[model samples]
Target: MSYDEQGYGNRDSGGRGDDAYSTLGGTRQTRTRLPEGDPGAPHGRRPARNTRSLVMAAGVVVLLVAAIAFANLGGGDNNKATDSGAPGSSRSDTTGGTAPTAPTGTDPVTGKIGSIASGFAHDEQGAQSAAANYAVALGSVGMFEKSKRDVILNAVIAPSQIEHFRSTLDEAYSAPFFKNVGLNEDGTTPSGFTFVSRTTPIGTKVTSSSAEVTTVEVWCTGLIGLAGEGSTKPVSDGWFTITMELSWIDGGWKAVTHSQKDGPAPVSGDTRASSADEIAGAVNGFGGFTYAR
Candidate 1:
């Protein structure tokens, strides 16, 4: 059966419906097309309006646009701090003092543990950035291989939890699970097929923070499957949220715990699916980013 037909995207690595990361876990571009024409409206321009009328119309539009932006930006109490661990709730000290006027994407970190970014800043923004990158590392293609998985865990997980995460995930990504996802029992891609696994963080929110540790939630969407001609498990995208509790240890933020839930996903667009070769080529051609918030 096809990957989508089997509904594998909805399940965890263990093929269970539980928290994917609690089980030990762990893009997009929009192509805009202009409308061809208004079917009901006449093609010719209408008569010019008086300056007063045009000015009033413009003012009304400005107000409407501002209101919409405010609503979408969670202007009011929507992102306020709460004790309840909700999807969007976070500590209210948005940038130490006032909220940021724009999205907070700083320069990418320089230090690396292998290819993963490291040495994040020591602040609230830094905590969120660490969590975001950790989510990417944990959700990477490397996690499927034992050697690479250990490296990723060492880079991202806290020293105290490294062995625990290693052992737990080893059991989670069992040979059966590998075969289920169209990979070999040894967690290697079969000949002539590309196994795609990548995560892109959409946005991040700080749940709570302190001098010692911080909790952050990263909303992410990922692609996973075997990409090749006649493959049953063609590459597919799935949305999920990962919450990582990171501690300041060894002068860097490392994951204390990780958990995941299905999503705060948007409705899927009606874009046509790409062929297996096209998907594989795209995955190979494009490189991933080190996310920061």
Candidate 2:
């Protein structure tokens, strides 16, 4: 028979008669007890059956107390339910969404590249790519040549601010500055010396950003010197931060204005300097990259 049918049959038969003894393999069993009020009854008191019932009841009570204690001790699903209702929980009560907040503290040179880039459109990756390319162009050897400088300026600067940028830069790279950097008045390199002026952006960051504009700061360390034998100003290194006010125009992020300042630089370590020829070759051979988020 099916289990349900068997259960129904047992219920119909009660705990006695054929159902109980038949389930135990046909063994006939009987309860041995004295008839009530019989003088021949042993011990004359039924030896207190209530004691066994009392012990069983005590065990059940102890188990119930242990279960309650376990629940209060932060065990099982009950504890989880209680914790969810606790005051001042970080978990959201409504949508349970947590938006990211702005980063704090003084920005570092290397990490700033990524942060600033993230403020542009197309997410962090787009910003990083723009920052990296901009850093390369800004720190390039092209800044010395008029034609290359014009090309770089046109490519990176916003259209509205191009004229201002050109005028300011033209004045800054005047004859005296060229001569000081070991170049001719026309910004040509002298014989036997390689004029080195390159900026390598270690990182990028966006302190603040929006759809129309992004305030990006590129932290860069660069090499700016004249590399050659008998050169008065040999190669030197510097750390600086470049803050670019960028605007989204013509499907790209372009700098509307830019300014730079000296850095939180550390002390230089004592190390053997490379030869002029080595530095020149390295600068010429190495190629820059387009960075991303």
Candidate 3:
């Protein structure tokens, strides 16, 4: 399911689970959790497109340009540094770099906890890698299941923040949220239906970094929903950026806190939306990447 179905909550609880995950706007911003429904529509149908949406789309284009410039300013150097001495470099100088639109042959961490990537290098690129992979894990189908969620949290969260993350997420993925997403209360998809929730990082930018801590922004696009005939929550696309504060702990980069915000999204093209079976088949056929630099 998409983060929207999860909804935002108190800080101690899981942050909001919407298109934009919980956001921290330089201060505490409290948001009430709302189910994924449009109240004015008949039977919670999505509202009709409005003029404001067009204006917003225009703004997103402008923002996308600025973001590209910013990414280019620092992305190249960082990528080269990442490309160079990843294995032995204790610190990488990311002062001037061009943000790569594709992978730069930077090797991902060699460690793994089940399918999760671990054992990241102690540098900026490592932090970015950790953030990207963690975003995938956080936005995956497993987060809906309690047992799977616990395993994921343990693998990605900093040791000190484990309990807080666990409790917060436990409360965040409530039964109501599950029902809203077309999943059973136990987080299982009904018979013959495929649930798809996947996050693919478009790129990563390091906002700040030190030997012990790094803050990275991962631009991501995702698909989430139930894929089957006659499904209310049909699979759809969303774009958001996840802000991760990662700390070097226990020989790996682990998340201390995370925040998300709506795009930087590009305008949608006129491409036809695929059928449910096509979408489901594609999701299953394409295995995800072990994201690196």
| TM-scores of all candidate predictions against the true structure | 0.68, 0.57, 0.70
RMSD vs true structure, all candidates = 14.8, 38.4, 11.6
Task: Select the stronger candidate by TM-score from 1 and 3.
Answer: 3
Candidate 3's residue-wise lDDT over 135-156, tens digit each? 8777777777888878877888
Candidate lDDT scores, in order, read 0.57, 0.46, 0.58
Q: Tell me the tens digit of each residue's lDDT in model 2 across 1-293.
A: 00000000122213222211100000111111222444457634333255434533432332232112111111011111123234433222423442332343424233223212323343333444465557656566676576776776677666765665555455545676566556788888898888766566666655555445555556666665678777665666645555555566766776654444345355443345687788878867875444433
TM-score of 3: 0.70
| lDDT winner, 1 or 2 | 1
Query: What's model 2's lDDT at 38?
Result: 40
Q: Per-residue alpha-carbon lDDT of model 1 for 90-187, expressed as tens digits? A: 34445565444255567767898998888888776788778777777766777778898789888887777676656655655677667666678898
| TM-score order of candidates, top first | 3, 1, 2
Q: Regarding TM-score, does 1 or 2 come out ahead?
A: 1
